[model samples]
Target: FTRQGQSCTAASRIYVHASLIDAFVAALREAISKLKIGDPLDEATDIGTVISQRQKAKIESYIDLGARTAGAKVDRCGELPGAAHLKDGLFLQPTIITGVPEDSPLMREEIFGPVVCVQPWDDEDDVIARANDSDFGLAATVWTNDLRSALRTVQRLDAGYVQVNQNLTIQPNLSYGGFRKSGLGKEASLEAMLEHFTKKKTVVIDMR
Candidate 1:
């Protein structure tokens, strides 16, 4: 759902093992390269215009920063696809950045665009720590075939919503919310309904 990565559930940061990092990144680049960037009305368009010019500029800056940062490599998804009417509109090519540091701006802040940062991790402890280092814990996704590893990692994540061996998805029956600075309160479930309608009562006794 890279509506140019504007969605809150977008997988912005990916931590991959050294053995499979190259393959994963290659696959992502290949997939991104084929995206059809053009007018929203076009049925062939996989990517449409950004919300505004300011957002486009911000996303571009992050891409540039990712390229300049040490230990970070930025790969743009080549030229924009055929978009006859989108020439003057705010359209940015899909980008994939690898070797990103945990503290890099691209990794630290929400890009809210079609830019994803890839980092390699050798240790599970380190990866979990890096994942939780974020101030925003909206959601997290753990992709692993091993059940033990998936459960362990999911338990350690500070995110309010978590998915194991799957991409971020919101079902109607699930409560949607975030931890830390992401947001407060809940929405879209029975829990949210109770939270909104139920009230607590306190009684004091003067027996003292």
Candidate 2:
């Protein structure tokens, strides 16, 4: 739940290979459950309040829909903190929903909250297709030791940035942007600066 999943780069949808789904989910659940949810200003906080009450409510509704409408098994890993001062805080329990359908709304939309939906796939080609099926192709990540597969997946996935064996990281001096509806132009690097700052003028002289 990094930054309470307010980041657009957050891995809200995880398409795990079928063989590793059980192990991955178990590990994720354990890790999420152990995170410290408290005052964001506190140095000890791992998960914090999202942004506001409205966002909290929207996220909570998505979590509920993941279970009620999508038939996914929702696991709310922990409790909201009990500090009296934080009683009214817009904090949400880090949630993981598994066994969700590929086409589930929770899987498709950008929840932009501390919620993740997981679906399993058995075929590499199929998984690649499913991962690229989204309209928002901001960024994607592939975690595997197989270099060939990683490279292939990276090329096939329709995302502006594709990380191999890494998540939520950007290279220095590189252009950062999104594909499809996630974004239009780059954000960093010289390319972005040129795109916005420089104008092109074509002057043609015809010599008869």
Candidate 3:
């Protein structure tokens, strides 16, 4: 997002191998470029329909926000060929946007969809700042082979959960909740018990 000079909240994460920001970008480009938009039931489809026309419209608005508010440079929207067969389908192209600044309105909003924004950071501090600057603090993942970077990311990322070495963290013992508006409740484990429950004080000073 910094590239587009826009700001973003913690939507998702773009992890890198510490120093290879360029390589990470290249990989993201390749991965996003290859998504095939079509029917989910079809085994050949790489990408599938977005659910409904409202969802498609919502996703597109964010694209517009990225371009106008965040300064993100966007590629032309690709029309899915296979989806054309459907009379009224929710097929929308996968999008990859670059140049969103860490603090733009484009980055701060939550967009739950197939659109992935690949952002590069100079250091952990930079990523942490951008990651936390938002109203929604759902979840974030840090991908790194270095234990130190992973450790620090966990310590600094202001989210409810920080998954390391993987994009997802789903364990029975770990508790999950959002920092802001993303969510207010907790679930999964003992951690939730602490966050969700209120403590009661009982007095037992019976005239001893």
Candidate 4:
């Protein structure tokens, strides 16, 4: 969870194909288990604290919601730092949830913390539709080896930026923004300056 999953472009809702969901969850759990949670300044710390106690509480509330929701399973990882190390820091272990309903707040809203929701998909068309069925369309990532499938999925995704086999790889030169409720206009690149930041003026010359 980069930057404690606070980034707007974080991969919060992950939809894995039914065939690979089991293996993907297993691998994710294993990876999270090895993460060292402690001070951000510590070089060995793989996971750090959230921005504030409010944020930590908000994230924990979502985790609790997932736990109480029927058919949903929450898997929390990593060890909490000792009371001596915690002090006033707001640290939370990484959490992965599965079997959560598509309409659940955990899946619909951005947690903006070290929590991710994993859902299984069977049909490609249905999966793409499900991915698009969200208020936020900031970014999306498709992980597939088939070039044709990847390209096809990328074209159909209703997001401002779509990446194949990558996540949060936006460069400065690329025109960056979001669709729908994400944002209004772009931020970087020449086009952003010209279209979003610049005002156009038309001059007229009368007679000769």
Report the number of the highest-TM-score candidate. Answer: 4
lDDT-better candidate, 1 vs 3: 1
As a whole number from 0 to 100, the lDDT of residue 113 in candidate 3 is 59
Expressed as tens digits, the lDDT of each residue in 1-208 for candidate 1 is 3687889889988899989999999998998888888877778788888899899899999999987887778888956755465569788888889886677888889889988888888999988999999989988998888999988888999998999877756779788888888887767799886895578789998996
Best by lDDT: 4
Error of 1 at 52 (Å): 0.6
Q: How does model 1 score by TM-score?
A: 0.91
Ranking by TM-score: 4, 2, 1, 3
Stretches off by above 4 angstroms in model 3 are: 1-19, 68-71, 76-79, 169-173, 190-208
- The root-mean-square deviation over C-alpha atoms between each candidate and the true structure, in angstroms, is 3.1, 2.4, 5.5, 1.5
Quantify all predictions' global Cα lDDT against the true fold: 0.84, 0.86, 0.64, 0.90
In model 1, the runs with Cα more than 4 Å from the true position are 196-198, 201-208
What is the Å distance of residue 130 in model 1 from its true position?
A: 0.2
As for candidate 1, its clashing pairs are: none
Over the stretch 1-208, how does candidate 3's per-residue lDDT look in tens digits? Answer: 1111112223344534347866766666666566555666877676666656786788788878766754567653345664347747766666666677766555666665555566767766766777788787767877768898778778888887767766444567778676878666777787677768656578888796
| TM-score, per-candidate, Cα-based | 0.91, 0.93, 0.75, 0.94
Cα lDDT of candidate 1 equals 0.84
Rank order by lDDT, top first?
4, 2, 1, 3
Better of 2 and 3 by lDDT: 2
